[model samples]
Target: MSTFFFSSSKAPSSVSSFPSFSTHSSSSPIHTFSESMMEGRIENAKPIITKWNLNSSSYTKAISVFGHNRKEAKELLKSVKDLFQAMHFLVSENSPSHKLVLAQTLMQIAMERLEHEFYQILSKHCDQLNPKSVSGQSSDESRNSDNKEASEDEDELKRAGKTITEEENVSQLAMSDLKAIAECMISSGYGKECIKIYKLIRKSIVDEGLHQLRIEQFKASRIQKMNWEVLEYMIKNWLSAVKIAVKTLFSGEKVLCDHVLSASDTIRESCFSHITEEGAMNLFRFPEFIAKGKKSQEKIFRQMELYEALTDLWPEIELIFNYDSTSAIKLQALSSQQKLGDSIQTILYEFESRIRKDLSKTPTIGGGIHPLTESAMCFICSLGDHSEILSEIFAEHPPRNSTITETNIGSSTSNHSSASPASVHLAWLIFVLLCKLDRKAEPCRKDLSLSYLFLANNLNFIIEKVRTSHLKDLFGEEWMSMHNKKLKQYALNYETVAWTKVFSSLPEKSSSPIPPDAAKECFRRFHAAFEEAYMKQTSWNVPDGKLRDELKISIAKKLVPAYREFFDTYIMMVNGDRNLEVLVRFGPAGLENYLSDLFLGTHILLSSSSSLSCSSSLGCIIR
Candidate 1:
């Protein structure tokens, strides 16, 4: 007695034909009739048996058919449904054949049905899902609205019994069926399809504007379920994709460096150009702004925030591009290096140039400082932590001679010999600004004293800035001290070198009175020196009143006593021999008055004969 499971070309047969249920002895008529009736029912259902076999190839063919031939898939689905119902009634629940066929057929039907439903939904919503379909409207809004419409259409289809609702479709899938489908797809090397399916589902949910909400729900569910392995796998894949994209984007160091430099230029121009007097005041005077009002201050603060954002962005880019590598290593592994130093230098140079240009347009006041000075100082201070890196880049550039060096004015050796590269670079930037200011003052050269005064004021401003801010630390305490000393020395140099010549006309303090010819010659020389010094030094300026006063007093110390003694002695000789009034050109009072006119940036010299007359009288005093 054998049971038969129908194959594609075979008719269904009974579970086990009653082996000639013996009508002899104990065979009950009721059982015999029941067995015969069951066989008859099985045979009747045989003609409607499905033509498809229960195998992987058949399952694959059915799925393909469902995707392209919906009508045929529907007929097949109905047949499979009928077949499942018949088998439940006719075959024993414990039969191995029944169990195998039931499991395989159920999974195949479920997968095919899911694919079919997905395609149907896609077709109906094609216009909404297609990005090209909606040209003018906001895509997200359009897609969301379309998704709602699609869901409503799906519900309508369900009500009409033409399609399954999403909930119903999902309910048809058992855990075992899903596992079987996954295993089959993976074993067949169609694992990527699984990912595609997941992405499609995500896209659909996102288009419906429910992605974020769903993700939150999923996360909450996952915490309770705790499927760590699946979560970890997903995270690993995501991270790997991100890493690949980063590597690709940063593949060329030169390109990356160029992009960074370009970005830096843009940021510098935008931020620096907005630095007006009011903006700068807001930046440096935060407490003042708070006390006053902060509305106008917001824009300035936002621009400042750009610098902070760039600062944060820079380090990450540096790390990824391996910018910390040594120069030798970069040369050897040139393919891997980013040439970060070149980019850094480009940025710094642009910033320096900007500062120079801005400061040129800035107005010079005796006591008040230009806003750029404070802004620039703040910018430099921001870079204080980057000093080591900046210093290295600065060291690579050769130092150029500046105005201080060009004029043969002496600066302290400590300023150059002991200063750090960063400090020197900062000093160079300031000097360039001063040089620009001097160029603007060139027209004032006719009054050379005013030009000099322009230089003095700007230089003094720089010295004070360095001494007061973090620039002092960068440029060093010695550097600041040296700058201050250099300024004083410059003042003294102007006085002694330019003014002393005027006093040189005095005759040597002689034990014997000079001859009349010698005294007359001394007076002539004195007149020339006094006129030259007065004309030259008066045009040159010392803008600071205190400084101007100090310079005048210094000139007086050198010339007053000498002129007085020469006058007293010469007056006696001239009084005895010649007219003392004719020889004595100027007395201590007149000389002191002349010295007082120095550094006022004025042209206070008397006419040549007037100057000579003034000198000739003093000429007798020496005699």
Candidate 2:
């Protein structure tokens, strides 16, 4: 009941069988089937088989002529084609080794058929009678010539066919086959092989196909199925691999560390697809890139949507809420960067939309406004360009935050005209920005701080705009009163000056209360102050109206208090130093024994100096 498949180009002449290897290894007698012995039996049946075209009856007679007994001959009488086909089906379905052997057999048979066809064609082309000269010379010579020509023809055909096979390296398959094999491996649940295929696809191939392969790989590595660490590793490596791809695209070489700057513009564009938040976290750990400072950071912000995941808006508000001049300056520089500007604007837009949706869907608690919303609003305002939007959002409030103390929420709602949390954080950030602006920003100190003040002054503008009752009605009025009070106390009254003087009266101390440790701290604070003063002056010189005056006063007021406090704290710490006693007791000399070379050098120098002095004195006495 078995079937077989065969090519008509070749025919079996006898019922020949061969030995098969057993599973266990052993030295054993090898049996052989001799073609010479089959020749006689094949010739005997050829006439009858040819007449019948080797039907079942002819198969039986041919097998019997080959000297098999009745039962053995009956088994051999089965169609050869059917037997071969069945073997092929079994091998393909179950045995890789057998499949490989069958493949090789097919290739060899194809080669043999090609050789036979080439020889037949050559024989037809030749002159039969004269042989060498259109059937020339003797009969033996003509036969020899025909045989040589046929053999040469066979060799040429074999070489040509083999060349075609050799030309098809593993790489020469149509990309479709490659992709199918890769996907098949993946479907078979072989992740390692799938990754290997993906790696090869990306590196060994190019064009749009690589892009599709990468996308496939990306889908394969999604978060739900993968652990966080694995996902992180995969993304990071993908980024690095893509960078190499980018380099190959633009420059035809691998990217080196030193070459980063040269390819920065292109790499920024191409590698962005790989710049997931997870990947950015990986990049940040690279100290070399981080130290390049804001440019690199800004580039990451521009390339990836990382800020969405990282917007810890509330902590940031609390950090710069006090309007520290230094923090304000850093914030300003940050906002000014072109890339940062785009990112912050985008983040704000997304945040605003979210907040609007949330407010409509959810009601506020009695005293708690969701601080998350306020935090978002505060961050936007702090950027200093979105105040109009911020003011509008906070206008209609029983103060919209969940974390605000219940008692304070009432006071806050009543004092609407005073300044919203958003404005406060904004003002603080702006002040810090102005401070960071150094000499360049100093002239604008007044301008920058004044802008902040303007935001604060109109802080109640949101309240004035709203017409709702109760909390809403008090918005403008409450804010105006609080605003006026804050300005009088901090901005106009001698409070700033008086406070500065009081802080100044505090004792001063050496920056480094102990040797070495405080030395760096002292320099750091000094440099910070110097830079703040420098940038502020720089900013102030380019002034713009009342804003300029407002910023200058604020900066001066802030600097006096902050510096005086720094001095008071530093001095108190410094006055308690026992550094000199410690050094003189068991310090330099105690460690000198370990530094024999340094100790010797110092001794030699001192002796040389003393001898020089003695020599000079002796010479003077002689004279």
Candidate 3:
């Protein structure tokens, strides 16, 4: 009889035509006929639902249907599954309307009870269902909670009375108590009610988690109006919040959603999308607003940071919001990344333009490094530290007006492929800086030697900046080697122009001995040449200690030996003369002492770079 009732053909046409049919009044002319047909199944099912129903006064005490009353919860789900089967049979019998009504009413009551249980468990186990816990929950561990429920699903087949729907019973176990309830409600065709309860409760948890993280949706106009300090504070909060929102809070919800609604893909996707969509859109939309804010070199670091945080979490975002309905969230995230990249690229081009068009003409006194060189190098290095994200950004907007190519970039840098876009962009920025530094060095040209010294000082400063920062990797061995060779050439040119006259005033160390009169004239010429170069080069500045020592040593190696040999050969020729002391003013020792004083920069340069240090630390933290 049970087998005949389950086939679609057995269900009477009139009952199957409508979704649900119920008539509460039991006093009907054909009530006896309906009762005889059902064989007391409806009456037996009612007591089981009413007894274990969450609202029943006996089961009250806010106890979990699945937590404290595991035995009763098992019976409740089994009874609900069985009642649904009996309803199909009642529809098939061409029974009286009252019996059909009673079966539908009993399913409604069971649905309400399950709905209550679902809400209670979600409300009670928020911590357990939180992202950190939910995502951390191993599938193996969730299976343990459903051990009893699985047996009961199998046990239904062996029951002596009416058999339940055989709709692929959950033989394998990897479901929690909540998941079991969800599957039971869903399979019985009460899934809408279960899904409604879940969406309402879980959305609040996602919203509240974002609230605690201080993430909020802000309009572009409002963000634009904010001072950079205020905007920076929000960017920092976002950096911290985006990770938790994706990895912890939303992730936890996704795992719990997938587990509970595993029985139906469409239902889980609907529920998860409805729960996380708005909050996620709000979270990702923030960076676009920030990108829309006032553009300045100062803001680029924070903007790049916002871009990177979203980029870093992209995989998790795609996995969690992996549904057509939630594609808006993914699109919003992708949109923000593009906006930030565009803004950063715009600012970078502007920065490059500024370096190219700089109008500063004032030279560093004594030809030390120009201020433009310091500021530009500092800003460019800060950008270089974010090379991973910057590469992505630069790829979309291939650095504008860029003439720098692969041979100039990080072929030798570890962790970077040859001719990477970021490497080329950084190298291009540095090349722009070098051109500007050359213009800044031009004012010292009247004294041709001072011009070379200026070029050498700025080039050395640029090299050190690259070596110390991430730019070292971007502008690889080739760039480093090229610049180092140019710096040496500049140093050599300066030595030639500055000291050629001095070297010519004395004969070579290999020159033949001369008459006393000729030797005295040589001493007089050397006196005039050496004093002039010393007076000028003494006040000149070279900030680098190693470069300063190298310059001094190079000068010493050339001048000291020649003069010492000249002085030793000619001193006796002029010793008896009364004006000898005046003519032979500097012995080789005196020349060495004065060489130490050269390039000291003491007369004109004072470094006050406290702010630059702070910015360098900021770059490290951003990277």
Candidate 4:
């Protein structure tokens, strides 16, 4: 016999069919009539069930009543509600066992109709229910956008009502349709069917979204074997991908799942966890996978980049995957962060070891900035830029034995009391660099003054680096001031060794008269010592401009006035003597001009003449 599932309008007065039934006698002819009437009631539920069935011959396509026909959608929803009431009455009556079978079949048909409708709405409304839209619309808001009758019916079923949209946002309407069908099927005890379809479809959306973002399911082994450029590219893609995935993709899925399956927390959590967990774990596990590869200075920056990404997105991750079933996603994210931190720590240790173990004997020509000084400071300054992130990492893995401060200055100059653990570690690394540089200077000691120049150059380079980069803030004012003083001391030591012979050639005080014979002797010694020091210093360089100028000015202040005094006091004594030019040499203005040519990082020749004279403002020129 044909059956007819009654829509809301055609539903018979048999709406009272869900009432508990009793007969005057336990076994009577009236009870037999009840069975026949119940059997008719069961048959009537089949036409709408069969014709509107998702797989029926007449409607094989996925045309959702919810999406295209609000009238049919409302009728289908009413049919399912009535079917559940019939199923309840059959269970309570315990008679009409065959009609109970028929009722079960019709209920299955109604469930199938609603299930198809649920799937159709979700599939066709992908644009409307996209991650961006779903995230902003709450379940209550979606329900509020439902048709007035549908909204009232859902309030009875779920009471999911809220004021979120002033206008008819299409996403809200789409979500509302999905929610209505979901509640209908779930209340009919076909939640598993509804959830199964949901997980399959939504999981694919998540997977496809990830693929579009260029995120791969990177295994540790696969990522390790990949070329670094390829790995680095993927990391950049992931860095961009993770924010969208966490904040939008998975987050929106969670919001939608929580709303559509609001009738059952257990079902929704299971549905959401199954749909997105695997993809999310894979997303977060990417850093851990990369971290499993070799640790080197080249890879450390990427690892820290990954660490920063995870740390930055952790709050959202926790809140989205905030279910017991979804805890593994959080665990995976945390695991990746820890592994990246470890990789960073290993690379730093390797960096430190390289500095400590650098025993290369090559000294930089011109006593300029050394290769080690440039490389080590460049690396340390880069680390300083990320010190805020590293501060937390260093808290977990602090430097070992950073307090060994038996430096040439006799104590640790860096004051790390107010510094972060990151700053402390960087300061310790710089200390190690200073010690290495100290050892490096030994090879230059053949020229004791050159050795001091080497120290001055390197220390000056270090101080300038600290001044210009993020390291300045991290190292603090005290660290910079202390290092500045050390650099000045090195310069002072260089000046003392280099200029002593020249200064010694002249009398301690330039004063009164002198005989031409003694004046000639004094001038001869002064010319030889002055030319020697100036020629030597010209070959060396102070790369920093400020330091170089200061050194030049300091030397000028000392030598110019004293020698001018010597020249003025003794000139007349020698002027009248025979071969007087032998006792007279450079004029005071010429001496000052010659000093300007010093520290040019190139040497100018000076003639070893019997006498030389001040030629011009540019200094004495050898002929």
Q: Each candidate: what lDDT?
A: 0.43, 0.30, 0.75, 0.74
Off by over 4 Å in 4: 1-51, 54-62, 130-148, 151-168, 404-418, 510-515, 576-583, 608-623
Q: Which runs in model 2 stand beyond 4 Å of their true positions?
A: 1-88, 91-104, 107-177, 180-198, 204-481, 485-623
Candidate 3 lDDT (Cα, whole model)?
A: 0.75
Comparing 2 with 3 on TM-score, the higher-scoring candidate is 3
Q: Model 4: per-residue lDDT, tens digit, 13-125?
A: 23233334443464643444454555565666666666675445545433556656666677767666765665565565666577676776667666656766666667777
Ordering by TM-score: 4, 3, 1, 2
How displaced is residue 392 in candidate 3, in Å?
3.0
Question: Residue 135 deviation, candidate 4, in Å?
Answer: 10
TM-scores, one per candidate: 0.38, 0.22, 0.81, 0.84
- Against the true structure, what is every candidate's RMSD? 21.4, 28.8, 12.5, 6.9
Give the lowest summed-lDDT range of ten residues in model 4: 1-10
